[model samples]
Target: MFELSRRNFLSQGAAGVSTAMLTSLTRGDAPVSEKKYAVVDEVAFRGQTRRLKLMQGDRYMAALIFPTDYPTHFRLKPELYPVCTPSGVPVTDTHQYCFIHHQSIMTGHGKVHVDGTDHAVDFYRQLPYPNTERIDKFHKTHNLFQMGPSGIQKIVKADWKVTDQIQLRLILDWQLRDKESSGGKSVISEQRRYKLFQRGPYTIIDQFTQLSPHSQSLTLKADRHSLMGVRVNDLIDPDDGGMMHDSEKRKNPDGNYWDISGNRKAPRWIDCTGRIGNQTAGIALFSHPNNTRNEFYSRGWGLMILSPTLGHDVRVTKDKPLQFAARFVAHDGALAGKTADELSDEFAAVDYRKMFETEK
Candidate 1:
């Protein structure tokens, strides 16, 4: 064999290393040669027949599923809202349905009816506002509203991904029937589009910029005029209005509700700021302009609620579709806006497409 010099030996070694890396990169199913990022696995909860997955990547992100089934709905309280004291003894309760996190609040046992009537359902918890005394006020529903079979099918395309930012897309479709009212019987059919983006660990840039092109042409028929509003509640205080002073209300009289202010003919958009567990969360609500009622916002720190009706007496006719879209973006710190005027301006500038389209 020919003797090799030290330089030649080193050159050969470098060539071998480069070849190996090239091969690994070109291989279709090669084992990972480098450290891989974390991946989330599928998890199942009570009342969820199908398993849901939590995904996290360069950024921490998760989708909290809330189902419409009564068993699952009632189970959410203790499972997700357990009392955790930073310094004191952790409270424990054997009761299946208890608001132990907010010990001062009363717990009622009942089911949410089809007519949108829910007994023993705390509106404060379900639709809370600022200065509310109820503790654990910001508790979210177990899942988004139950969309039934057809509605669920439409959302198959809906999912979320997180990279340096968070992106969420949801498609909701449903047929509304009017069985309660007689006058102005008609059908309202439409589709809603929602998108959100996030930057940094806690800063969220949200957008509710699109509606189905077909939505503007559709007229939603409701027995009574229906409007969509946001509901916000604080979860850290007692269950009643104990901490709210009359002066506080006068100082910030908005009452945590923000109406979707825009043209009633095209898709209407609203932007608001709130807090989630000390972390600020941005919200964007979108609806078609032809919707019978204007969009309303029930917005508050620790809680955010969106209602399509004011008196809860609204009814949708057959063949009509009632659709709404919402986006939640976690921010790095408390939001900068102090009033709706300031908040709306900040929301208007957020570029939704860039937030969702950027690769992590």
Candidate 2:
């Protein structure tokens, strides 16, 4: 038998690795078009709150940030308007009184108790805007911040990271901090990604929230509200003929979502759809399997809240911070129908870790 020398073994091993890598690269698992680079731009608006818009490719998504010194304490859905279908049909409602608090899509709703506040914070409704007359003037950023609404969460600051150097996906980042939690610290971290497909387009929103008190514990009552929810356009109002469905195949008839009706049954996902002008479009909330709870505090007035309640109270301290992972899909078309099963099934194939990959 012929024996191979150490140098020969090293050189042959390196060659084998190089050859394997070359073969895999040639297999075309990664397309060059998807890796192509592009450019991005930003636009800002100061309404009742400050809003920021990010234009990536042909799609634009925005955010609403509660400003400093606002009597109410919280940042609402930044995606209030211009959330259109792939063909350019609007999916979000602006200025509807039925449920004025349904501010497009939001990340709030719960009676939370911080160390310094005696009242339970209601992030679900606009406590600051009492009547239709007031709300009409409330959506602008230049308006004054007042009190007498529900409990408010102070807005400390907002930070964002966006880039278009790589194609395939539009990567965006946001880190939001709340005013001193009376006696603690609370923050919301979101990483939003948009993928435009030939079939349609969808946004992948990933959030991580931390509630911690500097010297005390924060208590979150089993709430009917979610930290995140979707508010649809008025045209698809249950009164205007819209459909609300859950993954278990439970659905409410058209115009049924116009009231305070919804399911306590925890499903894997929930969705709502309505015809906007000429196009049929909708939004869906996908509760990841890893979420701690799975129920919806949905409303017929075009609000779908993916919050789960324990019918009791739970305490979260710095040591036991609350965490969650979920996704929202926005699409339009007969092919992009609001069927939770089909959507959920299609979602299972998603590699979230890869989709939400950071820009590094």
Candidate 3:
């Protein structure tokens, strides 16, 4: 286990920033000070996607992409692309064909129900199958909704606030195809927020998802893929040369459902690490203690998901929305189990769902 002290982490950042500042001076440009550097910078919001750059000083850390198109894009969701380590090695792969739905760092759910309706909607697996790159057929008609097997999450509104930390809030309508017409019905109103900050040598992403029924009550049925997911780069996949570690210390070599249990006990955090170029980099996902069902689906093929609705049914009422929170750590080296535990403790101390109450 690699134990990294707080002092060592700051020294590492200082060393890198010194070199970058020197390079800027050589180029005859005004050097950017560490204090004035923006962590999250909006790159572009056009066409079918809204992209943001996660940065450290002048270097690129990651790209957060939110798909604006609905049924047109097979997987209509937000994800982090090319998540790089501090040394500039990409630690996440968003273009893995075999698991096209496995986005770099995204959120998803499956087996959703709208009160008394028999509508079985899935937003996890996605359309046109997982392995194929062929696009799912889109209706060219003027109908507002494109009927398909996948549930669509259209961003009704998106707003961001950049303080010491960056907060991106999205108001989405979880729409499902209406079996009666060519249109779709909005079953749920979702408020998703991503609060990002820098901690030590890690870029910490805090995600909070609140789902309320549009009109009727909602039921999130038991599903293997319910909430947050992290798809590591191919180089870090265990099949290539990576490793996975969880709070429970359970080993899953075949990507099976070993951690999915009838009981409520589950791992608090999971880390996936491997060599990216010459540096060891990885991501750690931590589940909030307040979550009702915090199960995980970890795979050796570079996919790790913290599924909250697995093996249990969750009810979401109008008065009380189904709210859950998670934390993702993107760091340059293999995160230690002790460090994961400490981070998980810190995560549990805060109620991240409180931030979701206000619409900034």
Count the clashes in each prediction. 35, 19, 0
Best by TM-score: 3
Question: Can you write out model 1's per-residue Cα lDDT over 1-360, one digit (the tens) per residue?
Answer: 999874356335433443443354467433221222232434455435232222222222323232222344332111111111111111111222332222110111112113322321221122222233334534465321221111111122345554444344544322222224322111122232323232332222232322221222232222111222222222211121212111112211223332343222212333333332322333333333333443332212222223344423333333333333233333223233343334344554544433323432
Task: Report lDDT (CA) for all predictions.
Answer: 0.28, 0.49, 0.69
User: What TM-score do all the candidates reach, one by one?
Assistant: 0.38, 0.61, 0.78
Best by lDDT: 3
Q: Which pairs in model 3 have colliding backbones?
A: none
What C-alpha lDDT, on a 0 to 100 scale, does residue 209 get in candidate 2? Answer: 38
lDDT of 2 by residue, 109-227 (tens): 45666656675555455545334344436556532233234433443444444443212221221222234334223322234333332232544344433344445566777765656
Candidate 3 versus the native: TM-score? 0.78
Looking at candidate 3, the ten consecutive residues that score lowest on lDDT are: 139-148
